[model samples]
Target: MTITIDRRIYNDSVISKALYWLSGDYLIERSLSDNNTESVTITANSATDISETELETRLMQTLNDFKLRQIVADETRDIKTILYAKAFAEDEDLSEEDIHD
Candidate 1:
C-alpha cells in the first residue's frame, strides 16, 4: 500500500521511528516529494495476513506517539537539566529541599 504523509505534521524523524517499528512486518520504501509530502510504500510479508488499511492505521498511530514523545521531551528538557544538575552537583551545602523547589 502507498501512504502519503504531510511533512508539516510528521517530520522525518517521526516517520523514521514509525517505519523502524513496522519494518519487521513490512518492507517499507520511503520518498519525499517536492510538495513537502512523504510517500511510504509498505509491502507486507507473505506470511502475515495484515490488511493495508490496518498497516496504515498502525503507522499513523506510531507516528503520533513519536510526535507526542518529542513534544514531552522538549517540554521537560529544562526540568531534566535541572534535575541532573542537582543530582550531580558537588555542593555539600545544598539541601534536598532546594533541589525540589
Candidate 2:
C-alpha cells in the first residue's frame, strides 16, 4: 500500500520515527515529490491476515502520535535541557532561581 503525506503537516523527522517502529514488519520505501509531499510504500515482509486498510489506519495513527510528540519535544526543549543540566551539575548554584532566570 502507498500513501502520500504532506510535508507541511508532518515533517521528515516525525515520519521517520513512525516508520522505524514498523521497519521490522514491513518493507518500506519513501520518495519526495517536488510539490513537498512524501510518497510512502509499504509491503508486508510476510503474509499476514491484516488488511491494507487496517495497516493504513495504523500507520496514520502512528504518524499523528509521533508528530504530537515531536511538537511537545520542540516546545519543551529549553526547559528539558535546563532540567537535565540541573540533574547532573556539580555546582550548587543551579537552582530553581537559575531555571527561572
Candidate 3:
C-alpha cells in the first residue's frame, strides 16, 4: 500500500506517531516529495492479509488520532504546568481558588 499526504496538513511528528502504532502489522517506508508532500509505503506482515484500502484507512485514522493528541497537548501545556506546580511545589499551600486561577 502506498499513500501520499500533505506535509502542511500533517506534521512529521504526527506521521511518526502514526507509523509507530502501525509498525506492528506493516513494514512502513516513508519519503518526502519536493512539493511539500509525504509519501508512505506499507507492506503487510506475512501473517496478515489486509487490503491496500484498509491499510490506508487505518493509516488515516491513526494520523487523525495523533494530530488530535498533539492539539490537546499543545492546548493544555500551560494548564499542565500549573497543575504540576500545584501538586509538587515547595510551597504547597495553594488554595482551590488559587489553583483554578
lDDT of each: 0.80, 0.87, 0.82
lDDT of 1 by residue, 37-92 (tens): 98988887667777777777877899999999888787766667667776886563
C-alpha TM-score for every candidate = 0.80, 0.87, 0.83
Model 1's TM-score against the true structure = 0.80
Model 1 misplaced stretches (Cα beyond 4 Å)? 91-101
- Give residue 58's lDDT in candidate 3 (0 to 100): 79
Residue 12 in model 3: shift from native, Å? 0.6
Which ranges of candidate 3 are over 4 A from the true structure?
Answer: 92-101
- Candidate 2 lDDT by residue in tens digits, 5-100: 998998989999999998998999999875689999999999989899999899899999999999888877667767778787757344445443
TM-score of 2: 0.87
Residue 100 in model 2: shift from native, Å?
12
* True-structure lDDT of candidate 2: 0.87
| lDDT per residue (tens digit) for residues 10-97 in model 3 | 8999989989988887889999876689888888778677777877887899899999999988877667766788788977554455
Q: Number of clashing residue pairs in every model?
A: 0, 0, 0
